[model samples]
Target: MIALSLIPLYLVAVTLPLILAAIFGGPPRPFHQELASGLGILAFAIVLAEFVLSGRFKSVANRIGMDVTMRFHQLMARTALLFALVHPFLYQGSPSGGQRPWDPSRQLTLTTDLSALATGIAAYLLLPSLVLLSIYRTQLDYKYETWRLMHGISALLIALFLLHHTIYAGRYGAETPLTWLWVAMTAIAVGSLIYVYLIVPMKDKRQRWQVSAINRLSPRQWEVIVSPRGHSGLNYKAGQFVWLNIGHSPYSLHENPFSISSAPSSGPNVSFVIKELGDFTRSLHQVQPGTRAYLDGPYGSLTIEDRCEPGIVLVAGGVGIAPLLGIVREIRLTGDPRKVRLIYGNRTEEQILYADELADEDVTHVLTEPPQDWQGETGLIDAILLDLILPPVQVQDWLFVLCGPSAMMDTVEDYLIARGTPSGRILSERFEYD
Candidate 1:
């Protein structure tokens, strides 16, 4: 909840320029021109703030969840673009040129300096390209890491150009105080970039981890475990995940986030349940034990801690059971006595993993395709299945933790909400959702 609580503070930091400009700005220009300047100022501030909303901040990702933070970053970029796009057209008939001798304050004339206007023109063109590339990232052929690098570099260039243009030509930014404030704000935003690229990697050098074991969990799923070399392991709650980098240096950009399937109560060794999906995931089988590993995480807000719910209902589909297994294992390890039910669904019987290892207390295993004489629940875990698992009176107080395909999650969430379950009681982590 740290990031959720800090949202108001984040808004204040980003809107400081607007607040200061409204108070200390010079005599108002024509309505259209003033509107143009105001919109430009707001856009620049929001663009700068997008750097910190990139899901690398522990204070943000750990509290609101990385999915929420990253989604906000993507959405805000488009909003800032709309503002920047409309700004120039609003200044249609404004007087423009070098500051006139008659108008010493330049209140009547907008600057037309080649250097200032050039930066703005370049930034205006680049901003939309950056936003479009991001929105259509998956539709393109480039690797995810390549897209990520391009996104960062393009953003940095845009910020630099916008800073130069804002200070040199902006009506409010021309003032010494507002100019300095923008400089400070831009520096802070860029500082976050430095922290993620340099500082975090340097810190990882002191606390390294190495792969201790790797084993196939199912046909397409593998389990990898790592132990801290010389220190205590992560202090993460169940249902959290980390960016795991194996056989790569701390500075390498070859990491992917995976849920920590092992419970914190299971000693210093942490485990991950990874399913073969992309380039890196498919190569999990080739990874050897004792490989150098680095972790940047324990991020995500999905957890059962401090909850007053009488029981927990875990709804998992196929490999999505990874995090829920951690919660179930932890609960059993501590013997907390809270009633827990697991509703696991898979397409075929062979897809199920850890079936014998799982506790049988209210466990409902559902398979869409079953062989002859196959006993147990069959078919999709939908309304019909939910009705059998959840008693109507118990739905309001039980915590529902869901992870699966977006369709399954949406259906389960809608059903829960429709049946009197409070929104807060239904927790989910949709990191790759977008």
Candidate 2:
């Protein structure tokens, strides 16, 4: 229900400016000028809303899933950029000058004031650069933190610039009510950043955690366990994730999101199965036990504890088994009667995690490169493998949870839907949407 409410809320926010303009606007300008103003208003509104859609807000992300929130953020940013790009072009043929004496409402002339035009021009150039850099961030040589800082600063600047441009140069923005609306919305947008960077960290300083243990699970994977120090522990459902900051200050940007591999029923200590991928992850081997850490979440909706489905199907690829492991442990620890099956896929047998723990469960392990004496199933978890492992009855009624590389998840989801599985029954979470 919370997720469904976001759509109408978003529509109202983006269209509110247009509605107010129509009510308070003194006169209707030419179609081109109105088009220019409407697009400009919408673009600014969307950019402001992007601040809340950064996937950091638990109220939004926790219910809808972080992956979906981030995808929406990306798509809307591009759309706003397109709207901003086309906004000025529609007013090209209009006469450019200061407000005329007879037309105090400025309906017949475009503002030629240098300061107002400068803000709009500056935003015009910076918005595109910001979007392009984000789209190709991985291709660049900068560190992730550096890129992140630059992105935030750039966005804030764009918001400020757009706010100034809208209030001073917009045909409808000079009205008192519309101006106040923009100010309030901009304040909320900027406050979201302050909340994320400063307020959240200040709160985390009290509820600290420490690395209790770190163990190499495989050649490329490691298990990190953190125990709460001053508090009881996190109150997260099994299969959720948290942003972990290790050996860094609570306010530091050196945090990374990882799924919890430990079940809530087990203990307060939370475990993460991390594979060496980014710079922070590559240094996991060197992290010492008892190092101070802070967690900023219990985010993501990749959980199954509340579901009424009679059976559960867990599909994992490589280290994507982290959250699924938590779910399996929860079921075993709590003695849940619902039947559970885990279809775990990896390149080799050695890459599999918690083999002994999962030995008793109905798990089908798939290996792309199995050893000569291997007895388990071989090849990727594609249509043929799924058909062999999952019977028709199970496919129709069971809840399917997936977390994996994008390609694997897409293949599994597409195949599952083709087999008549309802979309609502299949839940998935992705860390990398691109």
Candidate 3:
């Protein structure tokens, strides 16, 4: 059934280039190289629009296949560029068996044809931009938003240029199936973009959250509690996160994902404990109560409900403790008496964000520092602590949840594995961006 459904898509992917080749009189075997190229370009534009319009990039990145979707996007962009490169080479070649004295350099020198030159230049400019932006997204963090907007605009420009290039070069200005196909694809792409940019914002405004209170948890950490003003409660499981836009400046695409620190039982008021880590977070204190905020999810699979084990082990470091705290609070609220142990790690005693509250919970604290008078576990969390604390039970019967800096989680996972913990029972949540 799935294969049958994918047949039309497969046909579109494969034959679009052939149609282009035939239309352009570029390749004899394939109907038209230009028509095929047009279809390829149009199909890619549609896919790009679908991704952006559905707002699934981040969700796909974090959930369906972590880091894999990013690679796929990069691959598709490169493939589009390759198709663009092939169009000129294939079209200029002789349709007959004999070799023709056609030179690519000669074709480049002809500038009297403005449409062709524009199409070539647009293709040259846009393809490389797509590749470079996808590859260097993180490194060019400051220019990310500008590059993203430019990238979208450039994609549209490339599509328009390709359409013109096809129409003029192939002599299929009208009354061509390929022309209609191109038109339909462009309309779909444009409509999707409009909906994503316009209608989505209006819907988001109606779903906006109002800040109830912002409590200073520590010197730099704060717990921002918010609830939808004219809406019912947000149904989210423990450990899932939400992307928050505190000031709702549409131009300020500075939404950051934060774990819900408070349990869902806390009702309409969802709490996010944030530390002043970046420019956006540092400015959070200035945000007024009742300020409009946009929320984008309930993502991630780190909840305790997902685990069906006799006992649980939660390892957290710094603010990584936020989600773990939610899980703990949830367990307490439900009165689920499953044995849960926590090995909370921190750089120093002072930096431990939720020290008093964690101490009050029925959980163990493994601090990285012990004062002169202090007599709790100290130094990096290692196998020694695991051997000392972890109870004797079948490894599969216990679920280990690790949330912290990647390095800390890696170390803890390795130690747990060495101590006979089954690989399936160990789950780690990464809070960092790729």
Candidate 4:
């Protein structure tokens, strides 16, 4: 419902400026000119809204998944860039000069003021560059932190430039009421950045946690556990993830998201099944057990807390088992009668984590490359293997939760839906490398 309601809020936010402008605007210009101005207003509004959409606010993430939210952010940014780029070109035939004596508002002529025009030109060029750089971030060799800093800085620059160009140079925006409206919108957008970097970090200082233990889970994976200090741990449902920062200031960029492999019913301590991957995670095994840590979530919507399904089917590949471990463990610890099954896949036996604990559950372990005398499943978890394990009845009624490599997830989700399972019953988490 929260996700569904966002559509109207989004519509109101992006269209409010255009609506107010039409009501208070002067004589209507040519159709093409009006379209150009309208697109300009919409693009600015969208750019401002992007700040909140991508700000990691719980309000957005809790409804639509984080992957969906970020994907929407990327798509909308490209859209706004398109609108901004063409808005200037569409005003082709308009005469350009200083304010005319007959037309004090310059409705018949484009502004000749260099300062106002310069801001618009700068923003027009920088906006596309920013969008392209982000789309190719992982392809570039730069550090994620460096790319992140540059992305934030570039966005702020574009917002400031557009704000100046809109207020001093825009036809509808120059009015007293519309001027304050743009000011408030821009202020809210800028304030969201401060809220993310400064305000949230300050709030995290009070809910500090201490590392309780760190142990190797596999050759390339480790488990890090932390106990809340002076507070009950996060009240998150199983399968939710948190942004973890260890042995660093709350404001540090060292934080990364990891699913809580530990169940909330398991106590006040949280455990993460982290695979050694990234600059921050690679050094996780070296983190001391007594070091202080901070967390900023319980985000993601992969939990089964409110689902009415009678059974849960968890599919995981490699370290994607992190969240599924929490969900299955919660079902066990709480003695919930709802049926549970886990299909965990890995490249080799050595890559598997918690072999003993998982063996006790109804888990079907699959390996792409099996050893000489392997007795268990020995192929990838593809459609064939899924057919062999899950009966048609189970597929139709069970709630399927999946977390894995992109290909594995896509394959499994498609197979499940094709086998008569409801689309809503299938949940997936793409382990993005951000």
Candidate 5:
């Protein structure tokens, strides 16, 4: 993808100018500084381009093998921070080593430069703290909401600092001709943040769903159902997810995205069968019925639309079957004549998340530890089991949707590839946290 290619392009664009500037002199020529600033701006532009092209910011980060999308975002933020600091430091024509006051450059080092120094230091300190908060978010899970709020606050602070530093240090206020340019760029950055946070969330709240019921499926799993008010049905395709905010500020950063485990035809009432994998989800049992819940998605492209051939193979492990359940439900509702086969694996027969519902379907249950009187497939869902269940259809033609742990997906992918299946035909969604 172009996003992958742009990573190296950005690296070179940002680094090459600094390399050339350092070799020339203590302070490079005006043209060199312009070139470096131009490169920095270009790198930021590329990040925006990558984000637009990929649709989601996370895709670009995932393409580059970064653990999270926030890392790439913070990387761009820090780059901007550094550039803002350096512009004032390097361009200031100040004399060093306590030279004679008669020097023209020495006049620039007056104590009146305190504003520039203060703003630069503030920006420098705040940016890295924001980056650290983003990087170690999982470890600091208890303070995730606090960290998120602080992240936004710091962004505003950095923006203000950059505005002040640029206006004062660049003398843009005195230079009436360049005043508009300074105002425009600052407005664009600040405006973008507001649009992403405030405007978008307000527009999204109109798509809220009312909670119908929350049934405990197991000690660590739940089946949550929500009915849309009036004629506003939550129209989402199978395999897509929705962001859930349970009775709080709509702008609260505490919402989590979960795949819709029921079909859109399930009418006004949409369902999400969630597992208590984290702190946020572990408290799902406490949520009362008739509570307000905001839904903000139906994102993700893992669907059966790409599948054209007969005999579809759906492989799911643990609660990863949520999305696949929606797909199966849709297929059954539409009365499609296509033969569908589901291979579901779980740690134990009792621990199978949707054992009862799955038994009613044309699915083969594979449990690691079955009860004494149990009659079903055993052991892991490996190449041997796949080969045994695979019909006479060509491996290249059949589409396989694998959603589970990364290790299991990797194993399944390798097995499929070895059996002459093209990588494109095998679509997978990693439900586990990276």
Candidate 6:
């Protein structure tokens, strides 16, 4: 209910500038001119709001789920980019000249001054570049950290460019009330960045942590454990994740999101099962014990704690088992009476993690490539396999939690829905939306 309510609120916020412009705007110009200004105003409003929706605000992201928040953010960026790109083109037929003194509203004469249009032109070029770079970030060869830093700086630059363009070049934007609103919105946007990059880090610096252990779980996966320095540690639920920064300053952008593999019931220490995929994970062996660390989360909503479902179904693929492991441990440690089942899939036996720990549970191990003399289920966790493993009653009633490869998750979610499972009965999160 809370998440759904945010949609209407967001609609009102983005459309507020347009509404104000219609009321306070001096005189009606050509329909195209008014539309051009409206688009520009709406685009700037969205750009400002993007800073807060950058998947850093706990108040917002926690309620809607980080993946949903980020997906919305990405969608809005593309929408704003479309509106901004088309803004200047709509003024082509308008009278091109400096704002006339007689026409204080500037409804007739469009600003021809290069200084006023330059920022808009710059933002026009840079906004598409920013959006394109983000869309193709993984395809490019740049480091993730470098790309992230560039993204932030470029967004701020675009926001500033749009702000200047709107104030000086726009007719409705020069109005006192709208101008003040734009200034306040821009300030809030910039302040959000400062809070994320500076204020949050400063606070985290006090609640420090240290690396305690790093062990190889499989050929290409590792288990990293960190212990709190002085605090009682994170008050996170099972199946939550954290932005972990090991051996780096709290303010550094070297942090990466990883799911917690250690249960809250276990101790004040946390563990993550990370696959050697990215630059940071591949270099984990170089990290030493007792290295300074920082955690910026406990984010994500993939937990199964406060549910009244008769049974819980945990589906994980590859390193996606991290949070599920935390959940399993919690259920065991707390002796939860609700029945639980884990459907863990991997490509090979060597890729499996914590087989011994999961041996006691009702786990269905599916592998694409099974070794000789294998006894567990084989092949991918497809619709057929899911139907065979999960009874119809369980499918309709049990709480289904899934995390893994996008294809596998889509498959499971679609199949469950086809089997009459309510959407609310399923829980899932995607790290990659692109």
Top model number, TM-score: 6
lDDT of 6: 0.90
Model 1 over residues 139-160: C-alpha lDDT tens digits? 8887777887888899999999
Q: How does model 2 fare in lDDT?
A: 0.93
Q: Candidate 5 residues 404-431, lDDT tens each?
A: 7777788888989998888667767776
Q: What are the TM-scores, per candidate, against the unseen true structure?
A: 0.94, 0.97, 0.69, 0.95, 0.70, 0.98
How many residue pairs clash in model 6? 0
lDDT of 2 at 306: 78
Minimal lDDT window, size 10, model 6: 425-434
In candidate 5, where is summed lDDT lowest over 10 consecutive residues?
46-55
Q: State the C-alpha lDDT per candidate.
A: 0.87, 0.93, 0.65, 0.88, 0.64, 0.90
Error of 6 at 177 (Å): 0.5
Query: For model 1, how big is the CA root-mean-square deviation?
Result: 2.0
Q: What is the full ranking by lDDT, best candidate first?
A: 2, 6, 4, 1, 3, 5
Please tell me which model should have the higher lDDT, number 1 or number 2.
2
Badly placed stretches (over 4 Å) of model 6 are: none
All candidates: CA RMSD (Å): 2.0, 1.3, 6.5, 1.7, 6.4, 1.2
How far off is residue 303 in model 3, in Å? Answer: 3.2
Instruction: Give the TM-score (vs. native) of candidate 6.
Output: 0.98
TM-score result, candidate 4:
0.95
Tens digits of per-residue lDDT, candidate 2, 1-434, equal 56678899999988999899999998788999999999999999999999999988999999887877888999999999999999999999999899889888888998999999899999999999999999898788877778779999999999999999999998788999999999999999999999999999999999999999999999999999999998999999988999899999999889988999999999999999999988999999899999999999999999996799999999999999999999999998999999999999999999999999899999999999999999999998999999998999899999999999888999999999999999889989886743
Tens digits of per-residue lDDT for model 4, 1-434: 56667889988998888888998888898888899999999999999999998737988887887767777888899899999999998999988888889987768887879999899999999999999998887788877668778888888999999989998788888877788888899999999899888999999999999999999878889999999999988889899999899999999877888999999999999999999877888888689988999999989998898789888899999999999999989999999999889999999989988889888888999998999988789888899999999988789899999998988998998898788898889888887633
**Residue 61 CA error for candidate 2 (Å)?**
0.9
True lDDT of residue 422, candidate 2: 96
Off by over 4 Å in 5: 1-114, 117-121, 155-189, 204-208, 360-362, 368-394, 413-423, 432-434
